[model samples]
Target: MILPKNNYLKARNFILTNARMIERRLFEFHFENGTSEGVFHAVYAYRNSDGGFGHGMEPDTASPESQPLFGIMALETLDEVGYLTKEIILKDFMPYFKSITTEKGGIPWMFRPKSEYPCEEHFKTVKEWAAISTTAPLLGILEKYEIDIPWMKKAEQFVWSEFERIKEKHVFCYLCVSRWLTFLEHTKSQDKAKKTINNLKNWISNNGIICEDKTDEGWGLYGKPHGLNYAPSTKSILFSLFSKMTMESDIKELISRQKDDGRWDTWYGISEGTKLEWAGIQTLWVLKVLNNYGRIQY
Candidate 1:
């Protein structure tokens, strides 16, 4: 089941040549024993004076302006490299979170980027509304470090209440469910988290959030996450929801999807400017997941 050495090398070359500096550093950190500081320095390049991130850190938009989505991506990168420290959270991040937060204490999924920046057309359509999609994961990551800021109380309240209200048909984005699971994983209320997770498992089982058939071309429907995208590893709470055969089929199909250039296909639309950048990011993620499943050899 190991990813062949040649395949790994091709992906390594693709990342080194085409990936953004941050993603390149991340690749090195994960596979080549590169230092976390290298990744941290690369990540810092994306930060704005407003204590937030931008400059296409997420690759969905090349906006230089600070954004909540970019901030989340930055946090995710830091978390991946084990640099999501208390000081980093407080000094580098909390202020930005405080600035963009709504009265409801949640951050919006996105803000309309200025017209000048090159971005996918979807950016123009995003509404500036608070999102459980954005807020829940942020809260979960913060709580992982036990960093209790004033902002978290309202956010925690919002996430908890929203999870309580969410129904099967009401769910649209599958990724949001992952965020909800993350919140449940770290929240102090273990009893509440367990109950909520059980409810979510039941809901997603019947909901269209998971694609059972691996061959379905619409698996990436409009760039939505796939079943494996939600549960990249066996450790994920959602992993058990899929049968062994389903997981294996999805993983086999995923490994086969790697292009001759060593990058996997993105389910979403991408502009010429972002195609390679997104590809590089997607390749790194695929390798990580394969490694997680013991499909890659050291």
Candidate 2:
């Protein structure tokens, strides 16, 4: 597994130079042989006054108020770095989600924050709905940690029931489907995992239209569907069916896409004032995936 060392260095340096302290420390823990203690502090630093995550750790939104979803984001990041089973992620966060959860037992996909919170403008206006994106990954985190919390059981049932209903016909949202793939990677329901990925692929065949930019047969695509960075290619639409997501082109593109200073750019940065944060996240995300797959060693 050959890595683009120079580019990897540049990406790491970009995180150090551009990211907030929490993100910066966490980046170090992943790339620089830094301490798990650093990860713990960094993960907790984003905890808002109300005990859930806020202050922008999620990167997509900039809410200062505590958000239930962001708590999962924080825990997921910690999970990425091997900080498993922190009570902070569950005890405090479960209540937040439970409060905002729909009657159907799913968290509102878009929990709109109060206007005063620093946020991405797009999130402020997003329509709320129950979604696999909100519930599925969180369940994956709980299952991975083997945490037997009561609320998680309810959420899991909700997610499975929803997927069962859509087993035959569904609209694939690249946004949620990508995360759903992550959940499936860690889920216990192996049979359901098989069924769900197939449904996702079928959704593409049904709804996808020809687009110059989209990969994966031009379905399940969003953002720069044509750009190499955003394109999933033929391998990606049904990528959920496979455990590993990298292709040779994915490695090459990961190398090629790094900016001169080392950060990866994102579509979010184009419209949001928080480009630095999102790009930092993008860089870290690309590095994590590449590193995990043995495409990059740095």
Candidate 3:
């Protein structure tokens, strides 16, 4: 595949710079500006504070602590930093994985205790969302550690079962499909992964451009349906890149959308009436995908 040349070198340099920033933060653990403690600290704080992870808010940001679903993003950031390790993976991170799952094998979007007020909306009984979102990261972490979590295996089974349940209706969001594909990739289930990608591609092709919402069809933010679409975080871009589903025309269009500064605004999540910044991390992520696919050029 021929890679686009525009800002390739600049993007690479930018990623290197950010990687250094991450390194410094990890070492210092108290960077004055920007997110503190790198991925390790973020994961530790998020799990301890919120009981689950999402995008919005930092672990150490403020009071009434909530877990940012972006914990998965943090892990992705750690992977970019080359800081992902078995010890850190198992000890500090995996515990959060356990909390998100219920006895019936359901995983919620957020996982604070029942006593938490507004935070309660974060809960969900949907096995599909739980397995796709939670288990994907769990699987990714396990693959990183080369150690298996039995619960994760059950989670995978649960996800596949739920996926089969919904495959006919095609009710899943593209983001869910993308994450499911990611989990399948980690588990080395190429056939199942490819099937999911084909289904997503079919949906996107027939449904017009995937925008943040059903209203705008042009490159939906993150996945389909409007409310969930957050343009700034590069969730859509990363998902496309990782799934290897981008058509040449689509990729060129995405390239055209790149800001002059070589960054894109992507949303992680919202917390305490605030959105988290994840562009730098997202940029590095996309660049890594392009590099691996031999799609990066100077």
Name the top TM-score candidate.
1
**Deviation of model 1 at 286, angstroms:** 0.6
TM-score of each: 0.92, 0.77, 0.58
lDDT of 2: 0.65
lDDT score of residue 214 within candidate 2 = 23
After superposition, candidate 2 runs with Cα above 4 Å error: 1-3, 86-89, 164-175, 182-188, 201-246, 270-273
Which of the numbered candidates is closest to the native, going by highest lDDT?
A: 1
**Whole-model lDDT for model 1 versus the true structure?**
0.80
- The better candidate by lDDT, 2 or 3, is 2
Question: What do the candidate models score in CA lDDT, each in turn?
Answer: 0.80, 0.65, 0.49
Model 1: residue 190 alpha-carbon error in angstroms: 1.9
For model 1, which pairs clash?
A: none
Error of 2 at 105 (Å): 0.9
**Candidate 1 C-alpha lDDT tens digits along 122-156:** 88898887878789889999899988878899998
How close to the true structure is residue 113 of candidate 3, measured as C-alpha lDDT? 33
